[model samples]
Target: MSINLSSFTPYDLRAKLGEQLNEEVAQAIGYAYAKVTKAKSVCVGGDIRLSSESLKNALAIGLSQAGCRVIDLGLTGTEEMYFATVHYKLDGGIQVTASHNPKNYNGMKFVAKNATPIGRENGLEEIRVLAENILNNYQTSLTNQNLGPIEKHSCLEHYIKHLFTFIDLTKLRPMRLLMNAGNGAAGHVIDAIEQHFQNHDIPIDLIKINNHPDGNFPKGVPNPLLHDCREETSHAVIDHQCDLGIAWDGDFDRCFFFDSKGLFIEGYFIVGLLAEAFLSHDPKQTILHDPRLTWNTIDLVKEAGGKAFPSKTGHAFIKNDMRQRDAVYGGEMSAHHYFRDFFYCDSGMVPWLLVIELLSTKQQNLHNLLKGRIALFPNPGEINFIIEEKEKAIAEVENFFRDQDEKAINIEYFDGLNVEFKNWRFNLRCSNTEALVRLNIETRADPQLLEDKLTLLKCLLNKWIKK
Candidate 1:
């Protein structure tokens, strides 16, 4: 079937999945990925979406036609593909997932050998072109090719075993945990992990809410990042008197957390906490963090006797940097946590394990673990504004702050405009994935200063929007 070809997108092709679009996109992606990597064997998997199975089959057919073997990992998370690709030493892998997107939306994430992401600059564009060509009937290069056979495989056991490599089983303390899978792909994985914990007598109580994997998404789209979507998990934590609350999106590539106090810990703080956790284990370890917000991560990394380096915010960039630096750990403020042992790929599952280990070893509550850090560096989190003239707005922010060179201290564009001033700093960057500007501001242990500066920046943003 020849699709419009223009309908598919870069990174992941996300759109309503009910129509024939899902299969078409999958086939195009499989063909494009196979052609690009020229892999002898490729692993493919999908999340709990209703269309995932059919889409995975269509993708496998395309892969087979491209003369590539397909190892089908039935009903798995995105990280499973990454794990299987590297563990099996396959040529390539593809995961059919839209991450945290809506129920109607579905997409795909592709990785080459060693679980390397295929982003825009690094082969994603080429894949996009090939997929478009195939969809539009211009791709006659590999038609009627000898098909490669499909084989079923399961990495659940191995993946669960590998997860324990980050923690000491003896140190795992008995504590109640509240988990909200949001009816996503994580339920089964969580079940497997809990089974292991129970078998090993790890002493952890797993209290589940919305644990069942339902494609209908009875609660919502499984995006815990949205404040409204987080209520169930928060309420469960308070009502159950759980020590920790963890939530995952569809496909489970990212994870969010809530303290026993029912307070949601922003992903920014988790990065710092995880950095500290990983660094304490390996003093002088190199840590990779996104440039969007840096103060907390840098401070924690330094305090832990490790080195901190900033990368442009995104998985591909962070993963590449992690591999290059051989960093012990890498984390984005957006809940994507990466590890050195995990093929430098991000996993929503690993962060919580490490955090649990941290909690057990330190014997501190989740809230206690974060309270001091939150107080030390008060931030208002990231604010996104829809402004068509993003470049103009960013330039305006830079110009507005340019006159204070003496007080500005330092200015850098590691990812976007990051202007540092005395006691307070803000990074105003235009989102690469959308037509919007994102602002993050932080001040030294002073909530008032943080709010005051945030208000000033909002004034600037509002002023520019009016123009």
Candidate 2:
């Protein structure tokens, strides 16, 4: 009965599998989840992590012990679990996934009925306390009266059908897509989609690499956001002369894109691209963007006749805002895109499908489609610093900018300290789990200004940041 409390984050659990998480801890959390939510039926699924299956099974046992029927989706992405929870009208659902963490790490993500998030503010704290107590002295429900049933179900077919609703297969031009799954859960969905494409006679060719779902992560963990991790997909894009290079994380909740030239497009640009795509036809739709990177998204969204608004970062916040405001789409600079059609949950699969559809509808390659937008708004992307005192560092940065031009700098506290100037802007935010602050800067077609400002910020914060 060993469990590390550090595994619990603001919204979900993510920690080293052996040291911080195991079968017993997962079970306790599962039982607590069932009891606290008073769920009569709970749906469970897992990613390809070596530990996720066992943890999911243990969680199922706990839910069943609490007299909840468990629908086990043998292996699926996080979005699929969200879909199932709402599609079946179940009381709650949980997906066992660490989501872009290292291979040795594993965790679980939770959603209440109708696929609403259950974050720390709402239910996680109660669940954590109850789980810890349960682990202190757990009981085996030998009595059938206390034990519920577990059954396996496949949500893949319906999930893919839902994905296709975003785009018309017949309209897609003949093109090759280099998809790098990075040996994670995404490979399964990619394979399934490929088969569907064949059956539908779609001419699109999927050039898949690192496509096997390996628990050991032979090609490395599935996070393409890292520059080092992006080489495989980028190079493949060039080598295969692909129309688009798409990459997904361990659990496939967020997706990254590369142009045909094998250059990785910053997530900021993709946000704008997607916002414009959605708004071009669906005019006046509300588009939500994170403050960390907003200039481009706001510009594109507004130009497309859509209303653009800012939402705090993270899935919990974005989903909640989307539901509240009835936003059609919400995107973060981190590549997580949420859709209203998908029960306001973020889906890695949906974004790319929409993007490919956009490419087809516009009759342009991915490079041509995004190059103008990238040039119009140049950015250094999000830069993270390993900081000791994150709040102090953020304050120093904010104050220094204000002091430099008190009349010129306008600051807004949305997700972070967003400081705006005449021609350039930046956001400084602290990481919730680590002593790190992320900085994002963008300039209006001023690469030199972007460089000069980035260099200045780097020099200003250098002393306070650790290597």
Candidate 3:
């Protein structure tokens, strides 16, 4: 009985589930249950998508079929799922979310016991293979199992309280702040935090934009990385004369920051700030950073008496590296901040909290505190080039630059082609899941030179593409 793989597309399954059976979700759950054979119980959670409930129901059925008990924490973020894995002493956990993907898109994220991320190199590939096999088989013994007892545990309150423990509110000064949830799961989290502030008699003015959790997303996708999406958040801060602005992606797993002047602070600087913050308390601590942005981070971490290790850019990689290195903190230039205390997973909440604390303690403006580092690492942000020949284009650039005085710098091919000079460095790497190459370049304290080098790189890349 060969099952047609083409017939089991995620979209088709989504539609079929909407009509009659949730076979895709059942496969996911069955796969999870089979993976965690030793687990007596598993914690389950999901994002704010409408289909999450149906998918979760199917998943719960699969878990029960495998003789594993299930605990449901409905409408929670990915971080909360990680927290539940440890909080309830569950053997494993799954978060049904597409994260920052569009409203129509949905997927599942999984973790082993102790909140260990299961990515491609880890166990995600195995899970995917098993799930696909289960979906294709469809002839498994169907036991008329009774619905497992579901106990509702509201971890939101405890999650919020845990966030506050990482920062000192008493030292936070009264200031105007702008927050944008971008119509994602962050609305509930932000509202909960605000309620806590009010309850504690903290006098802070909050200006909010798109704080409501509307899945329709009248603005667009909740990704603040796009310039168009960030405009509203930037405007809110400037218009309200707010001291700072913060925006979260769809699931609120990553957050972006804006200073008092409505300047979009690069995630690199935020990483530096977080590294310094963590190092202040735990000197000589190991810090994990993505390979994309290295110079500034390495310098900052070293100056703060911390060892900086570069990991491949992604949540799973950072989480794995953090666990291996026992790093106190990890950060990516895309604004995902990971904390060892927070299950070694990225959190949108911690970065802003630490930034607020830094401002309050230093009594300095955000821009001023980061001015020197910003000058040192004048980045052109990240530019994506869609090409038919990604590898060829990368090689062309490497060859063109390889012969330009080797004695002045070093070239490393860890993740991609990284060319490091005395005062400048750049990395050009193809995206893992997209048909494009991403370019990130930085120089030592000269904006003009940075722009010039970026312009040259783009022209050079264009020439390679044409060839």
Candidate 1 worst ten-residue window by lDDT = 2-11
Residue 411 displacement in candidate 3 (angstroms): 1.1
TM-score of candidate 2 on Cα atoms, chains taken together: 0.96
Q: Write the per-residue lDDT of candidate 2 for residues 1-467, one digit (tens) a residue.
A: 54446678888988886646889888878888988889899899999988888999999998998899999998888999999998788998999998888777899899999999999988998898888766665442222357898999988888888888888788887889999888888888999999999998889899999888888888778888888999988889999989999999998999999999999999888888888877877888999999997888888887889999899888999999999999998999899999999999999999888888888888998789878988888998889888989889888877787777345557877788988888998888989878888999999999999999899999877889665
What are the per-model C-alpha RMSD values against the true structure? 2.1, 1.9, 3.4
Quick one: RMSD of model 1?
A: 2.1
What tens digits encode model 3's per-residue C-alpha lDDT throughout 1-42?
A: 543322222111212233223445454545445453445677
Residue 442 accuracy (lDDT) in model 1: 86
The number of clashing residue pairs in each candidate reads 0, 0, 0
What ranges in model 2 sit over 4 Å off? 1-4, 138-145
> What lDDT is reached at residue 169 by model 3?
92
* Residue ranges of candidate 1 with Cα displaced over 4 Å: 1-10, 16-21, 139-142, 404-406, 464-467
lDDT of 3 at 333: 93
Candidate scoring better on lDDT of 2 and 3: 2
lDDT, each prediction: 0.86, 0.87, 0.78
